[model samples]
Target: MSHEQIQSCIEECLRCVQACNHCFDACLQEEHVAMMRECIRLDRECADLCAFAAQAMSLNSSYAKELCRLCADVCEACGNECKKHEHDHCQRCAEACFICAMACRAVAA
Candidate 1:
């Protein structure tokens, strides 16, 4: 992949990680926390995957493409879960996850 593409992917992954964490924390504070259980779980998964993907990309790992594919899947899942909620944090996180997923997919392609 080109340097610009790698850099863009990394940036998007980092942003996704941040958004996931923020959304996860905010979900915990909601009145309907019980309903947000799946979203919280996915938020953590998405954040961890994004972080790993970014690290692999930064190191130019041979498996970076595979990792990014997994990351994109997790990001899409997280975004879908977040979209089920009406909270501001969830909305923001969903947007970030979608952006990250697209970026990762581009890099993998």
Candidate 2:
């Protein structure tokens, strides 16, 4: 893939990482934190994966595509979990996750 294409994916991954982290923190502060356990867990997982994917892409690693594929799956799961919540942070995180998933898919393909 061209550097530009990889750059776009990297940007998306970074954005997702920020969104997931923010949501994870916000979820912890929710009135019913227990109810947001899944979302919080997924947010952490997704953020970590996205960060890894971004770093791999930055290094132009041979496994970047593979990592991106995994990242896409994690992003999708996180997005779905976030969508279940009514909080603004959750909604924003969901949108970021979905967008990042698409970007990851494109890079993987």
* Candidate 2 regions with alpha-carbon error over 4 angstroms: none
lDDT of 2 at 21: 97
lDDT of 1 at 33: 97
All candidates: TM-score:
0.98, 0.98
- Ten contiguous residues with the weakest lDDT in model 1: 64-73
Residues 57-104, model 2: lDDT tens digits: 999899999999999999999999999899999999999999999999
Model 1 per-residue lDDT tens digits across residues 1-109: 7999999999999999999999999999999999999999999999999999999999989999999988999999999999989999999999999999999999989
- Predictions: Cα RMSD each: 0.6, 0.6
